[model samples]
Target chain A: MRNVAVRNLCCGVLLVAVLALAVWAGWVAWERYRAANRPLFHEIGWPDLVPAGWTPPDVLRGMNVNRYQDGDPEAIDALARMKNAWADAPAVKALDGRLVRIAGYVIPLDRENDEVHEFLLLPYFGACIHVPPPPSNQIIYVRSKAPLEGMMTMDTFWVDGTLQVSTTDSPWGQAGYTLQAYDTQHYEVPAQSNKS
Target chain B: MPGILSLALRSAWNRRTTLAFIVAAMVLATILLLSVTQARRSLHESFSQAVNGTDLIVGARGSNVQLLLYAVFHIGDATQNMSWASAQKLARHPAVAWSIPLSLGDSHRGFPVLATSQAYFEHLQVGHGELLQFSQGRMFNDVYDAVIGSEVAQRLGYAVGQRITLTHGAVAMPGAAHADKPFRVVGVLAPTGTPVDRTVHITLAGMEAIHLDWQAGAPLPGMHISAEAARRFDLTPKTITAQLLGLKRRSDVFAMQRAVADEAAEPLMGVLPGVTLDQLWELAGRGEQVLMGLAWVVAVAGIAGMVATLLASLQARRRELAILRAVGAGPWEILALLGLEGLGVTLAGMLLGVLLTASLLPLMSAWLEVHYGISLAGLSLDVTSVTMLALLLAGGVLGSLIPGVCAWRMSLSEGLAPRV
Candidate 1:
């Protein structure tokens, strides 16, 4: 009887001790974690480089730009649609040289649209207006020398002087993609027949 | 059953001195479990509320999380500044219901100085569309006047008419201070248990005023002016970091976002607050999960300790068992007596846990609101809670039965002889 009693007593002490240690260890670790987790508010300092261009519409200022990952399906679909439209990009061989005109969404035709005259060419249906803006889903730039009126629709046609692809970042499109335009024309959306 | 429970109660009461210590341990463990759950839930809700009713947060160009952090919580500094012109243009959009302009890069003491329009109070809603209320004075009335949060007032002890300088960062260092213009506290907001409580809110004009004599992050080199003199300058903020927009139609949010991205004027982006917050929660939940898991382990250890205490006492309970058997008690009755004791202890300890948790709600609320931008869920018995208690009670009873079964077998083998 005394043997069992002694054994049980030792087991009780061991269990309690181990549990107490676990509690203490957990508490110590939590305390250290709390102390180490001082808010990063005060520590914010100027970065070595200011972002170089119109930030991707998906990105925010002051946010660590390195953390943004654009995986929006709608934006991807829009990009794919534009890529499809640019396949033949309408007979560049037919109108080579002599300042020919073509229309597309004003994707920054050049990388430095903010500083230089460049931006990408997108489709007409995707224009975002003040009343119903494009989902902050894509970085669609319009290289219009003139102010834009109404929706920057996906189907609206614009004239690009020639294909000059400059990779330099635009003044405003910092840490972003800029496409420049040579002279571009904004085209009205053409009516489509309703064929089921 | 009463007789059996009476014997068990007497036995537990006799060892109550030791069992009571274990109960205290359970009380602490329960607090750890419940408090962590409450803290995390509250923080997420409170954070979502600080931005109130805005559908999207638009900024010059950066990460969505960055915009959410500064434009909403004011926890971090904004890296990019948007021209107030750009914000105004976005506001001109037909779909926009309202837009609150915000300028970053200024602080009052350690609290962030949010240069926002009064539209924030008009639009800001918290915890089920509740409007912001004042604990003391009203909102900022004058251009240089400020409205502080409850925590800011309590911590700095500033009141109406008390003047304070603005700092650029989260700290109170004078080097980061905009000492040229001192603003009076005209209003204070009630405690919202969110980042709003820790921030200092001022007019966008106020932000532009202090920054008028500065360029980038410094005073315009070789150009200087007094705060009073600067007030004479036009206060229209030429640029701002971001704008919060509410649309007439929720469906137009995406389209508007795309328009801003495609702006012929500037490269800009707008992000939905709910979507951004979810992304952040998924990313930041890793550390939180680890912490919660550790606390859960403590709760388990507490339950195990209770079981172990009951198990250990069985050996000392051998004489009591022998006396019962000799006095016409069956082996099953002896087991029942011990089982009831374990069950009673669990119920008692849990009762104590409920009391401890109830008493600690205020302290927990204060700690969470000040340290983390979370509001704690109030103390109430919910489905999850009922389920947890059921598991603990069932587990405790079953665990104590282990020793009861052993004693029953031994007593049957030895008849009236003491197993110990």
Candidate 2:
């Protein structure tokens, strides 16, 4: 009985050691897998306030941003399609002159007294900084009634404003939409939750 | 099973000196294989991620890789500068959304000084679509102000508001320093893990201002203009080494490239950075393969050492094997015991290698990033590495066959002479 007990004790210890190693490896693999497929954002809260007639921003990017052909009629046609794509983008007629809230990083075009009133609001940081700005549709020209203080370039902000679907060309890049913002607050992303 | 393992452990401990040497060989071999693979993978990744978002690199007629090296990586000097007129004309093209001109041929303390317009800060990109971000201060707005990269700032211990002077040429030769015109540090960019982190940036006006009185690469006699007064004159740059172009549409890249190549104003060349980078990888891939081959040879030698030690020990362990046979252990059990012992050493060696790599990476990661533009992968083993180690253990077991057979024969022959 004592011999059997010693044998069982050895087996138990070996099994536990193997299980610990296996668990650690599995956890690491699962974390890596989750990182690979993480969603771009969680709700960005756009649809909650979007009017019945309006379309989401990604829909515009999907339409004509990824594909284009150069030369002759195809070039002209592609340009037209791009133009129309922006015009019909966010295709919500109701969003025009409607009050909305959005978040983006600032690309200051003009500043005064360390304050920013006219700037490009970008969906991501680094846009218009050291990299080519994203598609015009991805940028918004924001003009604030009250100057936002301590506005550093590339700082994120949540702006409450009236949304306008229009295009404006700046020295830096082009913006397909405009925002007459009344309130701007610093932006922060909540800690990511492990959904899987 | 426990009895077999206990016997193997006691036997290995009895020859601990030889066994220790075998373990050390396995450890070195494992480290060699893992590091070579890691280095090759990271080198490929960092190189490919060097340039992105820019549609075309336009420069005076030159090799595509050469232009890429000089313009994007600051690795080589440009053969010739395209006329500033041509650069402006390229910028004004209808399909061009933005253009960032690059003017090289200057250095500060061995770090290249990149003279470009504000557009470089506004449009140039690095790995994975990231734009340059200032860790402190802001972009240089005056001709006498400069922005340094993270590596330059850390190495030289410079901070915002510090002053620096650049040399006229790429190297800091005596009397080549533009000491008459010292620039204030207006900004410092965050660590980028690219060549950009080792560069110093200044405006086009800054470049022209420093050379205002210089002719034929020497300062003109009796023409010392103060940095403040130099700003009074027109600092319009007449030439630039290269330009990165961003098009209104991605499809226009090929057309714009052809136009630049066939440009009548000057003999210019244009290349897609991504395509040229792929060509560079093809050239580098062969060297990486040779390194990996050498590492495998080391691993094979290590396995041979393990086999030799076990085979040589068979004569001394003959009475021990006979005692096992007397206790009813079969020939097949003797083989299994020897194979298991080899596998245990291999597994222990692999674990030690992984721990050593993991510990060394954190200490060396920053140094590697600053020097080689390589951010070592984190400690967790990837599937490929884990699979490789498993195969290594399998090979170690196979290598024990000669020793296993010798032990089996000794056991069968000496079963009756166990007392010896």
- lDDT per model, in order? 0.64, 0.75
True contacts kept of each: 0.05, 0.00
Query: How close to the true structure is residue B16 of candidate 2, measured as C-alpha lDDT?
Result: 87
> What TM-score quantifies how close candidate 2 is to the native fold?
0.68
DockQ result, candidate 2: 0.02
Q: Write the per-residue lDDT of candidate 2 for residues B150-180, one digit (tens) a residue.
A: 9889989999999999998877889888998
Summarize candidate 2's per-residue lDDT along A103-192 as a digit string, tens digits. Answer: 877755333323455666776665422233344455666888787776656678888777776533332223345778867788877788
lDDT of 1 by residue, B75-164 (tens): 666777777788887778766788888876776666667888888888777654577898878887677889998888988888887999
lDDT of 2 at B31: 88
